[model samples]
Target: MNSIPFDIVGFDLDGTLIDTSGDLAAAVNHAIGTIGRDPFPAADIHPFVGKGARVMLQRALDASGGYDDAMLSALLPILLDHYAQNLAIYSTPYPGAVQALDALAARGVRIALCTNKAERFTIPLMQQIGLHDRFASIVSGDTVGVSKPDPAPIRAMIERAGGGRAIFVGDTINDIAGARNAGIANIAVGFGFLDGPVEQLQADAVIAHFDELVPLLERWPG
Candidate 1:
């Protein structure tokens, strides 16, 4: 092990901190149904996640059959409406999620939420999961001029949180790319929506569960 080396920890909300697939699926299906198209299975939509809302919508619409710009334009609103309506119904933190955050807080680590999810949905989701209070900084996709993979979001979180040693935990390529772009180390989790081996993501580390974070943080150079 290279040993964890950071004081502040940043987390990607959707796949890393929360299991949002169910809610996302519900919204996707609702959109399809509203457009008079066949609803796609949750499995089919899972791969479309971790990108962004627009990309997910495009992927979902395409996978269902085929959707031209006109169809997609009409379906997008219904999808967002569905997600807004059923936001918290099926969404929840992963196992050990709360405890991990608690433990990190106890250790005096400054925690930040650096998510590509839009602010309209991000804030409420964190509140629902009881994690809003745990974060010293909450940087959403809409917070800055640029989103993940652009490094601005991560950089914003670190700067807003007082800027020190930091680590990022996420489950997607964008996460890895953003971390790299921000010049920070990243940790990838196995339980999230990413489609392949954690190693292929090229993150600094990869762990299987939330509690594993405790030990990693303990040994980090904070």
Candidate 2:
């Protein structure tokens, strides 16, 4: 029999499940470079993540130099186009992510992913990374006309995942807040692209590695 407490397990895409900083930095750099700005190192781009591309690019542009509305408007599409074509070039699953997913699946837990990443990028990126089929649901930022920190997407993810007791795992305020808004328990990954310390997200639980996930949930009273 399935022993895990939750029937559904939801995840955040970028930092939680995959390390996408390299590709994201590349896209941001491509946009900023058009204005003759220097590129940001991939690791430096981590904190500016968790939101969507527009916000991410805005932070990058703000950090590199500055931007006006007109300049940002012009560069947004550049960043997005570069990103769309190069989604998974440097993206890879976080260490032990695959094993965690496999363990969840083995125990009959339904896996779902919700991301602030829009459908255009999220879907293709997951497909390229060979994870699209593993999820029972994928709720993108634009999926329900709202995104994380709003609870709609998280709720939608659970419903689509064939709902039951659910727990969310992610790396940002958006994820923790979203799950809380949706009335589910949450776990925060210590190694994700956290803008601040992972504890600040205040997830119900915190894990430093995917290897700790199954054990964590196994202890959940649910």
Candidate 3:
């Protein structure tokens, strides 16, 4: 018998399941470099993530100097191209993420992915990391024609994952708030690209490491 409460568990891709800050910063630096802007340190890129490519690039540009619509429009594709090509170079799963996934599978919980990253980038990144087959469903920013905080994509993720009771795990407002918007339980990850304190995200629970995930899930009341 499955001990976990939810039949399906959905996660946000970039910050929740993987640490993409390094490669993302590298791509941002690559785009900004073409405009002669100095590169930002990878650690500096953490807060700029979890939104999407455009927001990430815009934040980078805003930090380096300032960006006009023309500058943003011109540089978006360059950053994306670089990211697509080098997606997995510096990106890796957070500690115990794979083990957590394995434990969930062992409990017969169907895992799903819902991320603000575009399919063009998300699919390939998962492939390179060898985690593509783990998710029963993968929904990108553009997958359902709307992104998180709107609830459409997440709702779609549940349906596509063979819906039942579901809970979401994420690292940003888009993830936690989106789960709330979808009327499901949510857990926030402390180590992801948080823009503020982890508690500010307002998730039902928070975990600093993936090792704590399964035990936490097993204790879920709902």
Candidate 4:
């Protein structure tokens, strides 16, 4: 068989690999509800994701009733605890995601995860989803003391995946900019938690489904 174009394929966790919006929204709502604010619909919470739990809560609080450091500090752990306990309750891989991962693995491509989700949460979430063992490397936001849109975590992902020509797949500006900052190509997912139109992301490519991944990767220019 011909070699795959990329030796390593890195992915962002929350939106790119798994749809964690339901549980995440639940957690955010739980935190906001503690302050007597109304719950936000999970769909409305999508735009607040991709950053981190703290940021997600902050955004929700800001939209609902405003927030302060003390309020955030108090609610952050509450949100995280709620999320951890219910990690996979509504989270699942996007349609055909596993098939795409298997296809990449079959081609000798290493798969790694680089997500802004903190390690404490990322680990349990992946474990609950039954995909923890599939990644060659898993770098959380806290793993390297930095988050995406900074390139540090992306670089750490590449190194941990054993170093190779890498391409990143994600669903946010942070993902696209991080890959670009790290000097790698990026593929944006159209079905992810996008804050704007997919075309506005200006990624190297865009795909509407996981089934389209392998073919796009195969045809990607070096």
* Per-model lDDT: 0.86, 0.92, 0.93, 0.91
What residue pairs clash in candidate 4, if any at all?
none
| TM, every model | 0.93, 0.97, 0.97, 0.93
Window of ten residues with lowest summed lDDT in model 1: 1-10
Give the per-residue Cα lDDT of candidate 2 at 51. Answer: 72
The candidate with the higher lDDT, 1 or 2, is 2
lDDT of 4 by residue, 5-114 (tens): 88899999888999999999999999888888999889899889866787888889889979899999999999988887899989999999999999998898999999
Model 1: lDDT of residue 176: 88
- Tens digits of per-residue lDDT, candidate 3, 1-222, equal 888989999999888899998899999999999999998888788789867889999999999899999999999999989988999999999999999999999999999999988899999999999999999899999998999998999999999999899999999999998999999999999999888999999889999999999999999886
Model 1, span 1-222: residue lDDT tens:
224356689999998999999899889888888767787677778898767767788988777787889987887888887797777888889999889988777767788999988898999888886779889999998899789989999999999998998889999988988999999988899889887877889888888999898897666554
Winner by lDDT between candidate 4 and candidate 2: 2
- Pairs that collide, model 3: none
lDDT of 2: 0.92
Off by over 4 Å in 3: none
Better candidate number, 1 or 3, judged by TM-score: 3
Q: Arrange candidates by lDDT, highest first: which order? A: 3, 2, 4, 1
